[model samples]
Structures are given as C-alpha cells and as structure tokens.
Target: MRARLMEATVELLVERGFAGTTTTLVSERAGVSRGAQLHHFPTKNALVVAAVEHLTERRGEELSRAVDALPAGGNRTRAVVAMLGDHFASPVFAAALELWVAARTDEALLAAVAPLEQRVGREAHRMTAAALGADESRPGVRELVQATLDLVRGLGLASTISDDSTRRRRILGEWADVLDREMARA
Candidate 1:
C-alpha cells in the first residue's frame, strides 16, 4: 500500500509538476482508498516528500545494479558516462526535479528534502567514482568526478525541456573522451 502510493505520486510528479500532484489524485491513481492514503501520509507534503525519497532511493539502487553491466574494457569510460546520463534522465529524476523546484520555495518541503538531497548527492558521487575506478586521493580526481556529475545533471535538465538524445549522446561521448584523458593524468 505504501509502495503503491509512493509510485503513483512519483508518476504524477513526473507527468504534472509538484503543484498538480495532489493527495486526492495520488489516492485515485494508486487505487488506494482515501482513508488508507491519509492513514499512511496525513498531508500532501508528507505524501509527496515520502514519495520523492522513495523514488530517489530506488533510482540510486537501480544505478548501482546497472553499473555491474557496464563494459569492463575498451570504451568503458564512454559506457560509464552513458550509463550515468541515462540514470539522470530517467522519470524518477524528473520527479525529483519537480520536488527540488518546489522545495526551493516551500520551507516545509525544503526542511524535509535538504538532507535527503545532500545524502543522495554524496551517494551519487561515491557511486560514480567507484564505477569509474577513480581514486579521489589523487590530485584533481575529486574535481573530475564532480564535473562529470554536474555535466550529466545539466544534461538531465536539458532533457526535461526537449528531446536531447542526439545532442546528449554526442556530448557524453566527448565528455567520456575528456574524462578518460583526465583520469589517466590524475
């Protein structure tokens, strides 16, 4: 029941920004009774915030699982970049974006999300470094990893506005090349 409501909330958040995803809409979409929904999440903020956290955790786990499938040699750098890009461009990311945008102006939402965002950011960095075989103890490696994450996040934002697959692919390829060179230097 909790999972259903959270999943529905994430879907609605992606389809219709934060302002449009209401508790009533979520209940109907989840096919859960209003009483049950309210019992689980008493307020809209409570429901949406919990939903965003749930999706964020799921997205991170999915990325971690997919990392195992990444190519071990050859254009592995490119593969890693592509994998990270795809993860950021997923629907769950979009839903998180909606929550982030709303949280910027809503104190209550911000209070709930700021810590989660920080944790997610740290985990993403850790995972990206691990996937790329990057050792941050070396000079410049930490910055390089951060740059890769920032670049992919920007790509994700661009994707939300339009169909950016072609351009994003090209950019990721170029970035992969640069990352390979930089990582080698570091």
Candidate 2:
C-alpha cells in the first residue's frame, strides 16, 4: 500500500507537479481512502519524500544492475559510460530531473535527497574501485569514482532534455576516454 501510494505520488509529481500534488489527489490516484493516506503518510511532504526516495532507490538499483555487466578491469571504463548513457536516455531520467528540480526549493525534499545522493556516490566509488581492483582507500581511485559519478549525472541531464543524441554520445565518449585514462592509472 505504501508502494502504491508512492507510485501514485510520482505520477502526481510528473503530472500535477509539486504545487498541485496533495494527499487527497494521491489517495484518489492510488485508490486509497484519504484516511488511509493520512494513516500512511500524515503529511504531503512525507509522501513527497517517500516518492523521491523511491525514485532514487529505483534508479540506483537499475544502475547497479547495468554496471554489473562490465568486467572488473580497465575495460569497463567505456562500458560504464555507454551503459549509463543508455540508461539516462530513458523516461525515468526525465522523471528524476523533475524530482531534482522540485527538491531545490523544498528543504524537506532536499533532506530526503541528500542521503540518497551520498549513497549513490559511495556505491559508484565502490563499483569503480572494484572494477580497477584498487585498494579501497586509494586516493586516485576515489577521484576517478567521483568523476565517473559526475559524468553519470551530467550525461543523464543531457540525455533527459537535449534534442541531440549525437551530443549525448559525444559526451559519453569523452567520459569514456577520461575513465579509460583513470582506470589505467589505478
């Protein structure tokens, strides 16, 4: 039921936007009673926070699975950029962009997004470090992991709003080139 409510909240976010989303609307969309929504969420921001958390976790899971296909080595550098490039080209990316924009003015939403963002950074570092088989504490490897995460966000933004696939590919290629260099160094 919480999942259903969160899913409805996301849909509401995409459709009615933050200003328009309400527990009443979310409950209606989720086919739950208003009392049920109150029982589950207690507040609009709480529901929105859960929705954003759900979206972030969903994306993180998908990213982990997609990047898992790459071999644990320098070769995965390009594959990381390409696979994530493909991921950002999806509708989910656009939805995420919407949530990010909403989070900018909403402190509660920002708070909700903060831990998830940090977790993503940590996970990306772990994955890249694993690919390079680096000592987890290595400084250079940490930098590369951070850069890779930034690249993913930039690529996701470009893919979400840009009309040019060529541009997205070019950026992905550039990120791949950078990763290729760093992965070798590590």
List per-prediction Cα lDDT, in the order shown: 0.91, 0.71
The numbered model that scores best in lDDT is: 1
Put down candidate 2 lDDT per residue, 32-141, tens digits, no spaces: 88888898789887787777667656876777777776666655666766766676665555655676687788887788767765775576567655654545465576
lDDT at position 60, candidate 2: 61
Write candidate 1's Cα lDDT for 101-166 as tens digits.
999999998998899889899999999999999989999999999999999999999999898988
Candidate 1 wrongly placed segments (more than 4 Å): none
Reference-based TM-score of each model? 0.97, 0.78
All candidates: CA RMSD in angstroms?
Answer: 0.9, 2.9
Worst 10 residues of 1 by lDDT: 62-71
Residue 69 displacement in candidate 2 (angstroms): 3.4
TM-score of 2: 0.78
